[model samples]
Target chain A: MRVIVRTVSELCITAGTLIVLFVAYVLFWTGVKADNEMHDQIDQLQRQWSASATVHPTTKASATAAAPAKPAAYHYGKPFAIMYIPRFGFTWNKPVLEGTGTDVLKKGLAHYARTAQLGQVGNFAVAGHRRTYGDPFLDFPKLRKGDAIVLTDGTTWFTYRIDKGPYKTVPTDVEVIDPVPRKSGYTRPGRYLTLTTCDPEWGHSHRLIVWAHLDSTQPVETGRPKALRR
Target chain B: MYGWIWRHLPGNAWVRALLSLVLVLAVVYVLFQYVFPWAEPLLPFNDVTVDNQ
Candidate 1:
């Protein structure tokens, strides 16, 4: 009888230890791995941007002459833009990668493939993790109605204003990314950006969304814009 | 169960300890690489969504 009790206690101890370790792996180790990978991706993007900058030193001149065209075709899982939220912080920046697949999200914010391209006439939607995997959007709730979401595709800086939301909705709310989102207060089609992340911080039960409108755009060679200056 | 495992592990104290350590590591590795990934979809991690209603 004593031996049976001892064995049961030992088994309980083992199970408890395993549970703790698993939690650590999910909440901590994944973040460490993701942070490392995101930094590496950011570095690779910067290198590519500099190389292209040298090749197209005349890009600014052409940009001023021509109407803003669609962004370059994005390869899946590739880092295409660097998103900066001034309201998040002065140093808050995240790489915007293509695709919302699980693998792509592990690296950084992902662009919803079905949505409009960045800085385009329609909605450009994006998704990121709220709790784990570096918790890129952990502070997403803090965004005010007029917050600035600045994005750069290594050539042009696009500034989007918080026109609506930090609205809460379920994950299946696909209409939120529509060309004219039904409840987003816009009646006509226009340039918009939407950011989505899991709500409640530690649970994936719902999604928190923030909608923004394209306020301005400028060539990168012209230096930082007034939105980023402050 | 503990007694059965202890009896089956043929070695001195150090050898038994090393073997137990390796077994624990193997279990952890399997859980992380295979079991976790397989079970992730069923967990409450990614199912949030609303249809076009």
Candidate 2:
């Protein structure tokens, strides 16, 4: 009788163990599915907006001669999401937060509190990771002066072309936020985009900077392809 | 029957304990797998995306 009782207990336990493992796997799969679905939807939206873009992405299109009129809605505090970066092939449909802390970086897009807004008439600044944890800016090193960095606030997509430097070892010098980075008293050019990322991944000893001037700011109705805006 | 086989197969106490833990996890997982869907509201950050634009 005693032996029979022990055997029954073991069988029951084994059955329970199998069930738990299955549940864990299911939960994990569910989360992955949700994330992927959201990402796909955002990409589809970008395609619809950028259908007219004529250039093969890897090569810069001959400098676009036409630039769109600055949108009147360009405001200082409104949020924007990063629809995609063709140069680096990063497509994030998620809402972009303005800061680069662990949580915001984990999502996508950091607002670059130091730079100017897309239509603000100054250098719009933002930063992100170059590597580690789905690093969107990993290939930023390859971008050239004319490559486009697209930003959107869902209603419009703003394109900015690469303008300059992969600045190195520039201490966090909050002064970089002072309209002009690294240099003092130099008059900077028109509306620009400044993107910064940590170099080498393992160490934050240096900063990698990429600058771009506004190419065009297109509203959702202005024929901007959806694939370029999420 | 399968129950008879389970009752007779003897394993060390540690082994049995490990197996018991595995069993418990499996049962709990199954319960959660079916039960969690009904409790989505209680989960953290279900609507992670917000249109701040």
Candidate 3:
């Protein structure tokens, strides 16, 4: 009878260990799988957008003109495409939205505030979660200075490279669009991209900022690398 | 002792191994088949409308 108890105790310990290990394995894979699946979906959406982007004869002419060209209308599969530090493997399809909704933000896309119009010249920005639900933006910190960000309208793809920051977070305010950081001599009248995420993964005490200036634009179909004229 | 564990072990080890396999299979089936799909609705971003560009 004592031997029976000892055997049972040993069995219980072994079973418990196996169970714990199985659960850990499942959870870890769950997160990893979710992240991969999310990126896959975003990549698919991007490819579809690129395939269907409108190519206009107006492109070559616009490139020659001094005036800034406007982006095509917001479309799914057609939000601005960004290729970040490929080293960080940052790629996402940020669908332009007129407002932030659970529907819009879930697919690794940005939801524009309703009041904000799509593709407007001033401080056009979008937001996403730092964690959970295939949180692709979870590692915005991994981005470094001089990293590239590309936004496209099917016909023309704009490239921007990170300028500076790991800067202090600012409150959501109009000043974010002043065409320059206030009180700084950094003002320039050209296209730019501003990326934001929660300061720390779990906390929102501050916001992390990444800013980049227009590097160049290219025709997706033409596949020619046209450097942005500064 | 190690030799005894590997060669002289009782049928209980096999039984426990089988039981562990079954438990893992069942848990995985439930998780992938039902729990994940059910929990997907809890994600902040889900329905994305792609506008024609």
Candidate 4:
């Protein structure tokens, strides 16, 4: 009987250790790995943007000439833009990768492939992690109605105003990303941005959304915009 | 099962300890690389929608 008790105790210890390790992997190790990958992605994007800038001088005429061309065709899992939320922090910026695939989200925020292109006349929807994998949108609930959600596609800075939400809804609400989202107060089609992250900090049962309208745009060579000045 | 593994390990106490550690690590690697990813889709993490329609 004593031997059996000892064996059972050992088994319990092993099981407990395994559970602890799994929890650490999910909550901590994943974030470290994701943070490293995000840094690499941002560095690569900066390099590409600088190379492009050198190719075309930073004149307004050149910027206008370069503007009409739609963002490069979507390449799945590629980082294409950098998103900055002034409400988050002055140094807070995340690379926006294409595709919402699990692998892509592990690296940084992902753009919904089916949504409109960046700065276009439709909703440019994006999603990011809320709790694990660096928790890029951990402070999502703090976004106010006028917070600036700035995005740059290497050539122009598109500053959007929080016109509607920080709305709470279930995971199944897709209408939030419509060209004219139903509850966003906009009637006609226009340039819009929608950001989504899992709600409740650690739970994925619901989603938190914020909708914004494009307020202004400027060429990258013109220096930091007023929204990012501070 | 524990007794069987112990008998077949064929090593001194320290060697057996190292081998057991390696076995545990291999299990962790497999679970993270294969099992968790396969199970991820069934989880509620990535189910957000753009519209109900």
Candidate 5:
């Protein structure tokens, strides 16, 4: 009988230790892993940018060109741009990949494939994790209207100014990513940006959405946009 | 159970304790490197996308 009690207590201790280790894995280990992945994605994009001259960098002469150049097709699961939110922090930036798949997000922010490409006429939607995986959007609730979200495609800088959210909505509200999201208070189609992240910081039962409009576009030859100048 | 392992280890008490510590460290390394990563996506906290993705 005494041996049985001892065995049970030993088993309980082992199980308890494992549970604690698992929690540590979720909180600390994943962050370390994701931080490495995000950096790798950024490095890959920068390398490609330097190696390839196919992408036409917008210049002062081309800024007023008659027609906007069509962006190249986005390759799936590939990092294509770097996004910055000064509101998040001066050093806050993440690689924006092509799709929102589970595997894609582990690297960095994901661009919803169905939406408009960055700086295009329609909506450009992106999603990032709010809690785990380096907590990329952990400060999501701190986003406010009029904040600027900037992106660079290794060619042009697209500065989008927030107009509508940090709006809260359910995950099923697929319409939130519409070109002119109705809840976002836009009347007609325009160059827009939608940032979506899981709500509650620690859960995904709801989503936090933010809407922005393309405020300005300039060539990378020019310095960082005014919104990011500080 | 830990007690059973301790009893069966082919060493004196001090040596047995050292072996047990090594075993625990090995288990932790495996959990951190392989098991945790494989299990992360299966858990719910990483679910950040909409549309059940």
Candidate 6:
């Protein structure tokens, strides 16, 4: 009996230690890894942009051009853009990767592949983790009406203005990412954006969504939009 | 349980202690690189997506 008790107790202690380690990984270790991964994604994007710039040598006219050139379809599991929300913080930004798969999100925010491309005339939907993987959207609830959610595709700075949410909804609300999301007050087809993250911080039983409208778009040479000036 | 492994491990007390430390580190590395990532998807906190079907 004594030996059995000792062995069981030792096993319990080991299990406890493992659980603690896992929690630390989830909360801190993952964040550290993800932060570096996101930075690398952004760095790769910047390098690509610079390389293309050297080849094409974008003129001042092209830099100021606001013509809506159709963006090509995004490749899966690739980093293509960077998103910045003034509401998140001045230095808070994340790389936007194509597809919302499990591995893609471990790097940063993942764009819903089925949704519209960035700043397009449709619902440009995106998703990010709320609590883990650096908590890209940890302060998602802090987003209010009129907040700015800006993004760049290495070409244009797309500024979107939040119209509604931090709206709490269940995971089944797939319509939230629709071209004209139901209850998002968007009755017509237009340039809209949707942001979704898990609710209650540490739980995934629910989702929190925010809807925003494309306010403006300008070439990257314009040197940051007014919304991002702050 | 640990006593058995300790007794079986070849080396003096100091060397045995170093080996135990290495063992712990190996376990941690495996857990972080493979085990945790495999198990992470099974956990609920990672379900940050919405599916339409």
Best by lDDT: 6
| TM-score of structure candidate 1 | 0.88
Candidate 3: Cα lDDT at A21: 51
lDDT of 2 by residue, A1-230 (tens): 97788778877987786566545534454445445543553565456335533333322223233443443442233334554567665443343445444445444556654456554676666765454334556676677766767766544567776657655444455454455554423266566666667655534556667666667765544556543544
TM-score between model 4 and native: 0.87
> If both were scored by DockQ, which would come out higher, candidate 3 or candidate 4?
4
How accurately is candidate 4 docked according to DockQ?
0.32
- C-alpha lDDT (0 to 100) for residue A109 of candidate 1: 86
Best by DockQ: 5
**Candidate ranking (lDDT, best to worst):** 6, 5, 4, 1, 2, 3
Global lDDT of each model? 0.82, 0.53, 0.51, 0.82, 0.87, 0.88
By DockQ, rank the candidates, best first: 5, 6, 1, 4, 3, 2
Q: Model 5, A45: alpha-carbon shift in Å?
A: 1.0
Clashing pairs in 5: none
Can you write out model 3's per-residue Cα lDDT over A1-230, one digit (the tens) per residue? 97677778878986786566545434454456555655665576567665664443444544532233554445543334433344345344443333445544544446344222222344445555565545646777877777766555445556667777545454454344355645222576555556655556655555666666667655555563443222
C-alpha lDDT of candidate 2 relative to the true structure: 0.53
DockQ of each: 0.36, 0.07, 0.10, 0.32, 0.69, 0.64
Model 6: residue A2 alpha-carbon error in angstroms: 3.4
In candidate 2, which residue ranges exceed 4 Å CA deviation? A1-79, A90-95, A182-186, A225-230, B1-53
* By TM-score: ranked, best first: 6, 5, 1, 4, 3, 2
Tens digit of per-residue lDDT, candidate 4, span B3-30: 6687789689889888988988899888
Candidate 5, TM-score vs. the true structure?
A: 0.92
Error of 4 at A4 (Å): 4.7
Tens-digit lDDT track of model 6 for A1-230: 98899899999999999999999988899899999999999999999988987886664345433345677789988998899998889999999999998889999898999999887788999999998788999899899999999998887888899999989888988989999998899899999999998888888789999999998888887789999895
Off by over 4 Å in 4: A1-7, A59-69, B1-11, B37-42, B48-53
Q: Give me candidate 3's TM-score against the actual structure.
A: 0.55
Question: Lowest-lDDT window of 10 residues in candidate 4 chain A?
Answer: A59-68
